[model samples]
Target chain A: MKKSVILSILSVFLITIFLGGCGSKDQTTLNVYNWGDYIDSSVIKQFEKETGIKVNYDTFATNEEMYVKINKGNASYDIAIPSDYMIEKMIKEGLVEKIDFNNIPNYQYIEDRFKNLEFDPTNEYSVPYMWGTLGILYNKKMVDEPVDSWDILWNPKYEKQILMLDSQRDSLAVALKKLNYSMNSTNDAELEAAKNALIEQRPLVLAYVGDEVKDKMIGEEAALAVVWGGDAVTMHRENPDLEYVIPKEGTNLFVDSIVIPSTAKHKAEAEKFIDFLCRTDIAFKNTDYIGYSTPHMEARKQLDPELANSPIAYPEPEDLENAEIFIDLGTYIEQYNRVWTEIKSH
Target chain B: MNKKWISAPYLVWMVIFIVVPLFLVGFYGITVRTDTGFVFSLEPLQRCFEPTYLKVLGRSVLLAAISTVICLILGYPIAMILTSKDFSDKNIYLMLFVIPMWMNFLLRTYAWLTLLEKNGLINVLLQKIGLNPIHILYTNQAVVLGMVYNFLPFMVLPIYSVLKKLDSSLIEAAQDLGANGFQTFIKVIFPLSIPGVVSGITMVFMPAVTTFVISRLLGGGHYYLIGNLIEEQFLSVGNWHFGSALSIFLMIIILISIFITSHYETDKEGSVGLW
Candidate 1:
């Protein structure tokens, strides 16, 4: 009797292993890699139902993590959404495939302003997905003074109540902008000044945070934080006391775009997914759900009137005059790394 | 089935998962790609000794040691209590200790974020009692608390097993020899449990030293431990050579620690047996 029971258990385990291996072998599967919490789940289901193609989705916390995986030639990802500078780096390194444009007919709905940017000069390699400016996200209840500039972050009165981005580029950009230098400055003197400024500001900082900035800000854990525009919008929805400002000193303007990796096994299916996302109604749903600015012109018109006109979501041209987009720094990234390590270790 | 043949699958698994990976880490640790090709270089390994990196290493060791000591202090008494003759329903207590571990470690740590937040459950309770809410999250104390809470089971289990198997006649003999309770514990029970203590310390210290998540979640990215430094190098900076070198340095530290602990364990046994 014991032997039969053991044999039954072994058979059950073997059946599970065999069945697990037999998942939708005949269907085309499109593997998508994107930023964490960047997409609506229902969209994936809609795409799958409409196209009859199985979708395998993955999320990455940072662009660098996605880049490392693709660069290593380890994973076969059909689509990836990386920031502008990283897209440029991947294009230079020949890690991405140029879109045929023939397959993505809905691309016409993309705004002309987002086209032919420095990242992809001819708009050959990527499709603009989301764009936003980096700025200070502050709680109005915590601070009494007007919050216009980055200097307020260094005020000793707000000591241990300020949070900074843990990312090297974003945090360094804040310090550089505060010093009245270009956010992308690679000059030794300017970079050193930025590094020193960060070191000086470190003591007052409660923490260097990433995605948790939204939660902490909403919980009133910190009075001030450096956050992206989209995250600031999300936090505002949660807590009405929060206010976002683009500092007078200027800040980093960024665009995250979708691209097909060179190692893609289903380029056609990936293109189909991209075109589906670019459709007006689908793009509206995504932009509204994720709380980021969309580059789709038709989708912009479809959004709520208040949100479509919000200065934070759709800033005027004059507001963006001082905003600078991040460009691929090439080997100079090492210098930034050294300075960041110094600041962190100190 | 022959015993040697039965071990074949595990041998293949070890080579593929353990030995090959270690060889690759060592290779990456000592070499750098250049115009000429992948050439041998000590620069990456030597960089591990730089002041900034050394400080990170020192901080990691200090925090891990603190957590291990705390675990030992808390775990020993629990183990003893569970194994005591007067104790009842020991299995239920053991089950309670093991239950939280079945949940994901990351989820457990994430739960702490909610409990320790400014407007979280702990602060809400404090406010109810008219006490000032404490800001304990995102501090070194929180990080150490996470480490001790997660690793206390490793300290408790081995010591419990050793004490359970211990001969009760030894205790009876010590009592008959007119030794008091404290003297009996010090001379007999504690000395015999040194092996379990050593294993427990090794298990707790190794994982504590290598953990990046607890520090990242609880330390609020304020503390740059060695694990975080390595993670930054590989993930953020794209510097695998330096990361591999740091990993190798950590492995050496762990090896040295295990060797010292085992040596101490055997030394204690020899002295106690002679007594």
Candidate 2:
């Protein structure tokens, strides 16, 4: 009886909060949806405190979930953060609206290099959030030499000590990049090569993981991993002995960007929030907390000196040039799926 | 049972929570339109058995089968102990098994990763305890362990309820016929408990097949079950048509198998079904 009563109270409480969040259509409210643990939570509260606009925040684990959720409904979201490849796909599918550049005067705060890229070529639709290369975060204390490239990971010496990403795209992209192939390669033969590499590499994998690799990598549980850049930064700080290296043969350089969906009801508020987030102070806070590289130019200058010098957070200019950005592969998805199937099955 | 206005609300709550979401799931699944104002096509249901797709189906069935058998073997004894009434601290035992489940499913699976990885807790403990550490996390063993661990409660509770409801007199009657303990169990308790066993099996197998998180987390992309494939198609590929086809086919396969099982079991028992 008590349990049921408690549940009733909880339900009422939740409903009240949810209803309160659903503000008057005339009043300003901004809904920002991002990947879980993507930014500094404190900054969000600060934004709401200062701006007087209610913020509805939610999180998803992957790009696909964000994409599907936004496109599948009467979207409650005003702003969403999706990675480069997904942003490209969103643009192609017409799921996102072009940003009104005037509402976002702070767009000039972004770095020069990130200005015009494949996903949203003219910065018309998105603002870069966090950027990083997918690569091995290795323990210097355990391994011999500076972990130069992807081949070093495939080396037999690292067997059972190496972790791979659980993601199909990131894992396969590493293999694809190793073979001097584009991470976005839709060519069946190229995908097949990546598949074969994974099949061979699978037996040697210690484990495939996501953010928890940051914990395991720093805890000295695994010597190395194919990890996301933000996760690598977290790992590196945990143990200075750990280092993140983009492979010599090239690796994935990607960014998560904030965009407004076409179905968004509160576009003006969303743009306000985006412009607020782009402000150097807030952007810097997000970067400092998340430990991933921010694309915001002036915000980056505010990062701690030690963190600013970390190569994982800011890969060398040459390394950035060699790195490939993943773009949407529309119809050839079947072939990638097909190759991924064989790799996993075998 | 509480009050006039308040009591009326629970009935409304159950329907809204249970009936409404289910209605939405069914409604959107079959008849929803695309974002572009395009009417959703049955095209999502078309490619259910492309050879590649069939392989995923076969894999889901196999994974579920293995998990169900393991759950059966592991769960029965545990459930028996809990319902035995002879066992002290039965609630404690149940809680030990259930506390892990109460935690986030994803977190528990990841906890397995921390234990099973090469230099993880199990290995470190093994080595510290002067035994060789084994690679256990990414293997099929880890995947099955995670599944059985996650779904074991589903298997346990039903069987425990059935066991608790069992009449001691029935087993004694069989034993008075000069039957051994095993024979008495086989003849009376086993048959009587079939309903719970079947319910447990269905509960375990159905969701076990559909679980994407465990296979990806513990199987380490080394395994590709049907759920993962469906996820890949819909999310990664953005090929909604193909994904829809796969989902519809999976639903059909589930529906048909369930139909056949329900009919066959009911006919065999002249009444009982998994439901």
Candidate 3:
């Protein structure tokens, strides 16, 4: 008798979920997948309120995670934000749809220079969302001298107080640049050298972290961290003692852009949302809130001169002299994986 | 026989959730897709025997074994004290032990990060006491500490239940037979509780062996256990084939350990002889 009762209760729960799933098909919704903490959520509220289309926003920590989700094709996302090399891979793999610029009047607001980049050279598939430099974020009080190069990361004085990015590509890129090799070096000797550099630096590193770098730096848990320019700006706001610099050895310049996956069920609504985000006012709000470099010319002009002129946010041309954007490594990524594994295991 | 129908939902759930996924993992583990079509390949399995990966597997086993041993040492005493009739406020003490388990395991592990960080609470306390702060976070020690902290309750609960049910007459008889307190415990209580100890060790060791989050957060990515290696293959490298092979490899290790533990649990004469 008790088993019968439990069976009936389980049936009731399953039926409830099945019926609830069927009921949600009537409402129009656009799913937007972006990196964690990438957006000003207030804009999502405004977009939903104005468009009468429900917005289902989701977050991922890395491009690889986003790729796996999209590759699985389980949940249909109307829009996604992926980085430069990933965008290239998605285009080659036929995973994304080309944007209809005619539907997006605000495309004119995007700066000309942001257009026709190597990732989307034809300006067909993606719209630049946010761009930034991979650099060092150091606490002024903890360091004895000026922190302008990647060499400081290897300095024994700051032993056990250094935090490195946990990402394979970014961390490997740091070691590569520090050794005066190309960030995209595929040669075995260069890769091995980079691996050894990291293995040597491992003892001094406090931790390899991802998004937690911001909080740890803010809490004064680490003396230095390798972080993106945008997170550095956000962290600096929370703690003025923190400073950001693109090291003299050079670093990665990454651009994350908005694109629609081909599997999108709500193409029109997705386009509308993209255009809404690109509106000068909306774009300015996001740029200001996220503290990332904006690609919208009108939005950039609207920013405070102090912020727009800040070296960290808008570095002079010389600071970018050695910086290189990451390209899709394609099959060569396996080599990177092996080298990273070696470094980590060693 | 009619009552057996009540388990239908659970059987269906298992087929869909467990059996199907396992089949998929097995399918991917031994095959690779080529430009033409799918091909049977032992490459993924062969890669698992690489010296580098073998070393990682050894490290994972070592760390997990250490944590399991530590949990046994710590948990056995607590279980004993709790099950003791002479102890007062046993319920309250058990409740206190279980409070940390009530919080999410990830949150509990993260709390350790806050406490063990160089400039964190533990360091601050050390400074207050006029002692130099120790760097414990992001080390093998910290990873082991995390495993023990998270899985200690798993060890305690099972042993505690068994000890609570233990017949005191056996102890009394041992005393009557001229066995002292330590002798009674060694020959009688410990042997009788082998089942619980086996279960607790299994519970602690399994999760400790397979955990990626603790090693990622506490080991600082410098230390790559088998769990971390598997995670890297699947998540970052996007090589599901190799990841599935590694997972199968891990399952075999766990199954072997469980077998060894159960052997000790069942062999009453063999275990009691050790005393």
Candidate 4:
């Protein structure tokens, strides 16, 4: 029995040594949580190969899902990407960690315009990854009239041919803008009017879509879809018949930023990954692949000149004069939830 | 040898997976977070009785019932045909019916979306045939069609198995007692197949009542069912207390359905249980 036990122990030790040699014992692992389809996965592989750190990546469909998981504190995630208002909420709720820019030397590559935004005014918690605006993606073959206003979404002529965003804030922002109200208006009467407008538009809507909007648009399933500028760019690439435009009433401008959650297991590795992502070449590669507007000055110079000069990618200041960014709604968020649920139930 | 100990692992799994999670749901359903700690509160449960929620509940039940009844009407004849003495290659027929179910349920439902879209396959074919293209993708009828298509197999299989085992002696006796084809079916085959019908109803109704994907994908997210409400509470709104309360309400509905089904089952076969 003793000899058999010694043989088994010897085999186990040998296996362990072989495995340890295959994957170095000192290699650290990082867990990243971000929005679905938000990244070029090849960058993750590059990061892994360069740093010898294994990455466990997961994606969320909405900010609420990421917030709930972080709020529960059940799972430890090293890094997370959330939009502007959601980043503010996470900072307020103490669910995120403050970044130490000393470790991220590439932070210098970020443009001055994106440095001190409303979401992270002090530049303490988050780093801007991508910025986009909401707009309409219309098929030229299907839409006969000018598509300059959000009112066309409510037009009866396009009944069952209109696709709206499924997101609460995004959808509500559309309704709010169509009524000539601020996208972030907290006035009860304004919110009520927005709610009524959505209810009146519901019958004409083909569907309230999420990421599927891209596939449906590419498939020519609908005439018009309310989509983000990034998705519109990607979809328009696949179907040249499609055109994107920010309505005359204006729309929400959003910035999604990267942050480390408080429950991060590898804070140092997470910082390294963030810094790697901010590198000029890496930033350019990611922006080129994801088709989102980059906030890195050096990265923007490397982008396709045609794309960089396009108004949709670099809109003139006067064109976006009425554009508004979402701020943390805090307790008033519940009121939005109530209005949304009421609209849906109606 | 005592076999009771062999069941210990199963019992442990049940307690851990089923009982504990249900207890936790009940706990969350009745409690609200306070400054100090959680406190007992009925507000969440009471919120379920609101007019908006009640309307969602009514629509869920009404849609599920319509789908279940349609399944019965369509499935009964199919099951009868499959079990008939004149039918040949019975296994092949049953296999053909179940083959569609072998694919992923979500994929099948998604296929229906592409087929029924305004410019999808069905509409294109209709245009070629000189028929007006019907608007059927995002309506309540489309949701029912999805449910009926997906759950028809559940309704047919149970009834088919029961009808297959039916004693021919009873039917012959009914025929000998001066009964016509319809009379024999009403008096004999239908009465004896109650168990299968009951189980079929339970199977079809349970899934139909709680389906969120069909309603969301095919109904275009305009219509809110109870399942959709529960999903919104947990996923989008992050209202665990309210979500738990809604879940408990759905559980109660399922329990009541099972009770009513088993009650009639026992009335017919005293010791028989619901599957």
The interface root-mean-square deviation of each model, in the order shown, is 1.3, 2.7, 1.3, 1.1
Minimal lDDT window, size 10, model 3 chain A: A1-10
Ranking by TM-score: 1, 3, 4, 2
Error (Å) of candidate 2 at residue B101 is 4.9
| Tens-digit per-residue lDDT, A1-346, candidate 4 | 1222233355457546755778665667688887777778789889989998877777777888788888864879999999999999999989899999999999999888887999889989998999988999999999989999999999999988899987899999999999999988889999999999999999889988787788789998899999989878788789999999899898888899999999998999999999999999899989988888889889989999987776776777776878899998998999998899888888
So what's the TM-score on candidate 1?
0.95
Considering summed lDDT, which 10 consecutive residues are worst modelled in model 1 chain A? A1-10
* CA lDDT, candidate 2, residue A177: 84
DockQ (C-alpha based) per candidate is 0.69, 0.43, 0.70, 0.63
Please state the error at residue A220 of candidate 2 in Å. 2.2
Clashing pairs in 1: none
CA shift at A265, candidate 4, in angstroms? 0.2
- Candidate 2 docks at the CAPRI level of acceptable
Candidate 1 lDDT score at position B224: 88
lDDT of each: 0.89, 0.78, 0.89, 0.88
Using DockQ as the measure, what is the rank order of every candidate, best first? Answer: 3, 1, 4, 2
lDDT digits (tens) for residues A1-346 of candidate 3: 1222233355457546755876766668788898877788789889868877877777777788788889864889999999999999999999999999999999998878789999999989999999989999999999869988999999999988999988889999999999999998878899999999999998899888888888789999889999999888889989999999899999899889999999999999999998998999999999999999988988889998878888888888799999998988888888998988887887
| Model 1 score (lDDT) | 0.89
The CAPRI category of model 4 is medium
Which prediction has more favorable DockQ, 3 or 4? 3
Q: Per-residue lDDT for A163-248 in model 1, tens only?
A: 99888889999999999999788899999999999999988998888777887899999999999998888899899899999998
Give the Cα error of residue B194 in candidate 4, in Å: 0.8
Model 1 chain B worst lDDT window (10 residues): B266-275
By lDDT, rank the candidates, best first: 1, 3, 4, 2
